[model samples]
Target: MKKISQKNDKMTTVSLTQILENGIWQMEAEFSNSQYYAAIGIVRDTYNIPADTHPGLDPHCHHMVSYGMSGYQWGDGAVNYKGNRTEGNIAYKDNQIIKAEYDSEKGTVIFSVDGVQQPVYVRGINEKVRFIIYMCYSQASCTIRSLKKLIAPTTKHVANEIAVQW
Candidate 1:
């Protein structure tokens, strides 16, 4: 588990070193002092993190998809992102678990709060991506609890036996 805390007022974004490309992956994080702004999501591996800006809201960048604890989802860039407060009304409180799952096969990213899945999701992601977390206000922190790849389930067919009467 890794904990990321911000000491300044500027929004700070942090991303994992591992890049996920063609598989199903899941990440779970816990936020503290998230009353103001704290977000968890994914950013393209090629995205360059700005000095001080939200990953999803960075005007100069358009390769991010973020879900905030304040009940909002952001995709691409601030200019053409898809989401708002009303669409993602599942606000999370401090210490609540936030889960993000990405399926490269389906080209979708989904979010869940405290085990309950949210209706809002981001799609059309076919490139390599990395998990990211951001915090704005001072002393705001997020702890990455787990990051793992889920195995895809396989399908099987069974044979049925029948009895014939002569």
Candidate 2:
């Protein structure tokens, strides 16, 4: 696999497969935009990682996130997809999925994003997905340690027990 160290908060790097998949969806599928992202699905049904179980990895761990299972169309588009702009080859921005709900009576799915659940109707579905989990450090040292442990077979995917943000 490839790697890009010396990362930053906003400097989000996506997987190679993700980039390629996004390209295909943008061209073939009637998606809102040329890209999509699915990150919040990291925990699946859980709300957040519990504080007690969070522990430090072995001396050799390396990497922040463990592997995950996800199916596309992931990610909120980097732009605002207003309406059926994808029709007639028009363009709508890819948006994020803050929340998803099923409407019983209306027989429609609603997207709760940024704070509102808006209804959307898409023509097709793109199901290229992957899974991701966390192996993290709140600081650079923790990240470094985690990366080191990843090289060792005996080590496992674990986060720093403490959540310190400074």
Candidate 3:
């Protein structure tokens, strides 16, 4: 487990390792006591925490997906990119689980909270990936309580008692 703390919003940090191909990567995280906005997800290049860059808005870097206190968005760029307000306004609080499943062959990405799938899906992202954690303002803390990777089976295993509908 690794702990990352930000006294003020000036820099962003990325994981040293890259995500595995055809695997599901998950992390259990806990936000700090700050009332400000924070974010966590997979990112490549880094950007200055938005609140420090611009007031109110916490813009995301291009080619990443993050679930922040404000909302969840994905795309490419430092200032302008593709994103949307996550459905249900799902935000991470003191403790929550963030999961990302990458299908290398399909070039697809799926994000989830706890165990339920988040509607944010990114396709055609066939490049290597890394994890990122950041905040848009001062007084924020985020901890990666645990990290795990599950390599999904290439083929399905069916029991003999099961009937094949097809």
lDDT of each: 0.67, 0.21, 0.49
**CA lDDT of 13 in candidate 3?**
44
TM-scores for every candidate against the unseen true structure: 0.79, 0.21, 0.62
Order the candidates by lDDT, highest first: 1, 3, 2
Check candidate 1 and list the clashing pairs.
Answer: none
Where does candidate 2 stray beyond 4 Å? 1-36, 39-97, 122-166
Model 3, which residues run further than 4 Å from truth? Answer: 11-16, 19-22, 45-60, 71-89, 153-166
Whichever of 1 and 3 has more TM-score, that candidate is 1
lDDT for position 104 in model 3: 59
What is the clash count for each candidate, in the order shown?
A: 0, 25, 4
By descending TM-score, how would the candidates be arranged? Answer: 1, 3, 2
Candidate 2 per-residue C-alpha lDDT over 52-75 given as tens digits, one digit per residue, 9 for 90 to 100 = 211112211111111111221211
C-alpha RMSD of candidate 1: 11.1
Judging by TM-score against the true structure, name the best candidate.
1
Per-residue accuracy of model 1 over 1-166 as CA lDDT, tens digit each: 9888888788788888879887888888998886646777787898777777675554623666666665323422111132232243366667988888888887777677787766666667878989888787788888889988889712111233111110
- Tell me model 1's lDDT, rounded to 2 decimals: 0.67
